[model samples]
Target: MAARETTNARTLTIALAQYAQLELSDPSAFDHFCQSVRSICEASARDGKKIDLLAFPEMHLFGTGTAGEDEANQAQLDAAVDIPQSNGGETEFIADSLPARCAELAKELGIWLIPGTFCERNPEGGIYNTAAVFSPSGELSGSYRKICPWRPYERYTPGDSFTVIDIPGKGRLGLTVCYDAWFPELSRQVAWLGADIIVNLVRTTTPDRRQELVLARATAITNQVFVASVNAAAPQGVGQSLLVDPEGEILHDSEGSDEELLIDTIDLDAVSRVRRIGTAGSNRLWEQFRPDDPEIPLPLYEGHIKPLRWQPQQH
Candidate 1:
């Protein structure tokens, strides 16, 4: 790992890797996943990539649709031990172990890592779709739960709060799960909290969700923050992963079919510049447009409008 360099806040150099395969049901496979990711990080370092942060897609360790579901495979998925705290099982919660492991990995690599979302258990035995972040020091910085879960996700509990974790090198970072990206308010709120960047960890069935990707860039531009979207590659879920800058530029992207590393450098200064200018450039306008602004009313026709096509004549 290299020392942090002083650079433009808007020009944040980010390294993104798209992972293709993950077997969530097999707990033994977790080690292999970890090794594969570490190899990517090591290779990036060797290649002299000035990677301020390294991000991987969602559910890299465990497969999706396996946990908290009523399907028969749920048992296999739950059995995969998440390394509960060794001594009394008191210090380590099964749900917290994934983030803890990620912190250890970050410490080893000495780089900021956006370990994607994982299946987590709440204290009440319910499941939550969550993402954990680790700082360069191998410390568990913070975690974010998917606020708005999609269909079938109702089975998984929604996170009650929004959290932004601060890394020493990077400023505040916000986290949002897959479907949460569809909603602009998630990113907006984080930006309002003064986040410099956002990590959108997600999984989708296919690459056709390009509209959602556009939304991601929009979120970055509107929020005036850097957004690095880490998405899983083929064989596991949809690929077409991307990392977008505060200017809504696609800094790095991976094709939909293969497993590969899409690494790029971003200048963090762009965030500051755009935000300071605070025109349409900054996300401040989002606040200007209120949800309940009486002045901004729904469109209505002052005169009677004819229908495009008349309904069938009634008897």
Candidate 2:
């Protein structure tokens, strides 16, 4: 039998794929990878643990095809695919494309899927590191392009907006890619948009991954939302993927730089609980701001944090 769909909105089982990058240069290699994902879902089903959502690391689709950084960058550029823009209109996916394949996989496994970040070629010019979300029924739920690409190393064009998708049984999920987590504003804006869970896709081979774990916990605590940060395995990445609860507690961690599947069932209602009572029943950050509060000037971005507009919708 296929994996069962999540019926309860209060809780959700998620699978984080912490695997090494593969040279998916051809269709057969890509199919093999897809099959591996299917096998995992099937195994979970046999164990009576159906995963509601499965997420992979950033650039999981783009493997290091060459030895040098420049060559690897060029390989990603060469393998970049086109994604249709959703400008308040019906967004279509090209048949047999990476996104379409991911949709098919999601439908096949009967679960939500995030097949990691894809190198997307823009119609006008340049490329973006993008992540696509697919629902169980093979529909393109949403997609998020990386807003903050690692400077001086990554050549991706930054995305201008944040993306949040509402899962029927699960709560609203926000998307962030790699270095985007470094910027707290991104997570704050996403949380302000009514996201109960924030998913951060990362592919950091550098030692800075240690700091990312801290950021993940901080993001969850400040936003009062669950945070799932998935990273690539060692050699390709630092492989310290983790899940942080709304209370800023690390529920699960991959531990070291090894390929492993980190599975956990999270209480979605924990978001509402934390936001309602405050983290540890002490600091009510969200409730602290009032309607009469003054707007704080942000000279760096040439903007102000208006209290009136800063009120996030209660989950």
Candidate 3:
């Protein structure tokens, strides 16, 4: 992959599509979905505000509406695609896979796009819920597999790592799938890896979505980074896709289970300001540790949190 030119701009415009899933029975239906996405991008451009990044909810690609639970699961598994492992470098995706279509769309629209999660067939065996990120130039920037699959019900192989992508002129972004937000450690580690914003893709249909909202805000506030959590609309999901700022303020929220587009332009510099001055000029959580502070041992992870390593990467 060629290097992207850097810019000093610290602001980015994002569009979150709270989509309502439909019964897609064939490849033509999937094509229609992609066309609909194209229309959204075109409409935004016509309105004189080109979006820097556009995202959809998790499982956006596995919409088997009206199908039985068993049928839906089978369909997802059948449609599962292989995504190349980055291994800390640029990844080349299969030309005919769903990710390739997404990359083409991103390149055509000249916008960063996250078309949401896909069911992935792991080479070693088992299936995994994965999210792919595409750059404006059509590069397969990175992919993140869900580390925590909602247990018992979701029979997916959990991934062991977190992923963060640098978006050239924009800012660094961390990718997280649905249930991953429930674990604060995942978000913390992503933030510590220098993510300016965390993008959480979700497809939640249960009452727990209410609790997820609280987690979204808490994640933003605690990490002092922008949080963009997009969820599927009902009858497929519980909607309520939202964008939270570094101060944990809701910049844009759907609030209901209806299909809608949430658009916002956020100042990424606020992350630095919040971390430097403090959240509300009172809680400087990032700077709380003293120079001689002792490392705190974590028995659960069998590791220690060094005070020196507690601080997030500086932009």
Candidate 4:
């Protein structure tokens, strides 16, 4: 006989993990981070809801700091993680190693995880910002290196691919790093590839936080997909991680810049519906989730766009 799906099973209970200011560099730091994640998952399970996906901030493994270009870049390179090879042969069995012990914790806690972003060292003496997803069985489900680096200061090479992972029984998952959210075309690319949920791991400075927040919502609204974003806490960023629904409504919002977890159960089925607000949401029109026509390409200048620069000292 086949098993039946439960009501709560269809809904994904996602945990947005903010850094408790934890940075992973060695086995002990990795172990502690996983321990904290285990605690959260265990507690959430006790509430009769299981956390299907747990996402960390973009720089949770590197922490926050102010250092010279060389020192800063070197710090990230030193923290870069890789998969271990065995038997002194090129035939690889397991590709990932510890210190960023995501596979270990996922297997131990029996939950899926995205270990956020870290600096990835290329064999030819370059580094790229990378992130990964692990299955409950401790297998590498998907891996992504950021295509756009934060420029001169970041000192990382850009990856040349897109990664959208398939989660069985759930929906396709897409990964995007901090600056990647600024590009609407990037979101469109991921959505066109059948991503139901796009997870953005972000770290922003205080000055540009408001603008970044707006971009986060804009990405979800434009693509009509669920976005679960995790921003670094406190000194790294504002810690205002947001979970936006397809309709561009805020489902879960974190107000403080501190270590915390925002857990919410969202209905993925709603991704296919066009929301119509009636009487302040008292009535809703459920139209087919058809995307906007591509006939009128976005490149065409529309008057609806805001001015990018200040007018020349007005007349």
Cα-based lDDT for every prediction = 0.66, 0.85, 0.86, 0.71
Poorest stretch of ten by lDDT in candidate 1: 306-315
**How many steric clashes between backbone atoms does each model show?**
21, 0, 0, 1
lDDT tens readout by residue for model 2, 205-300: 897988999999999988888999999997788899999998889989997989999999887877776776767877777787788989899999
Rank by lDDT, descending?
Answer: 3, 2, 4, 1
Assess every candidate by TM-score: 0.77, 0.93, 0.93, 0.79
Q: How many backbone clashes does candidate 2 have?
A: 0
Off by over 4 Å in 4: 1-9, 24-27, 64-66, 83-96, 275-315
- Please give, for residues 76-149, the per-residue lDDT of candidate 4 as tens digits: 77776664322222323233454235676787878788877767678888777888787777667777888777
Q: Provide C-alpha RMSD values for all models, in order.
A: 10.8, 4.2, 4.4, 9.1
Model 1, 1-315: lDDT tens digits are 112244434334576677764665566666876787678777767888656677777766656443445662364337333323223122344444666667677778787777666677666766677777666776556667788887663456788778776555546777888788988867777776767778888677655568778988898877767787777777666777787777687777776647777777665555665554553443444334443434433245343222321111111
Instruction: After superposing candidate 3 on the true structure, give the runs of residues whose Cα lies further than 4 Å from its correct spot.
Output: 1-9, 22-24, 87-91
lDDT of model 2 at position 102: 82
Itemize residue pairs with steric clashes in candidate 3: none
Q: After superposition, how far is residue 314 of candidate 1 from its true place, in Å?
A: 63
Candidate 3, residue 217: the lDDT equals 96
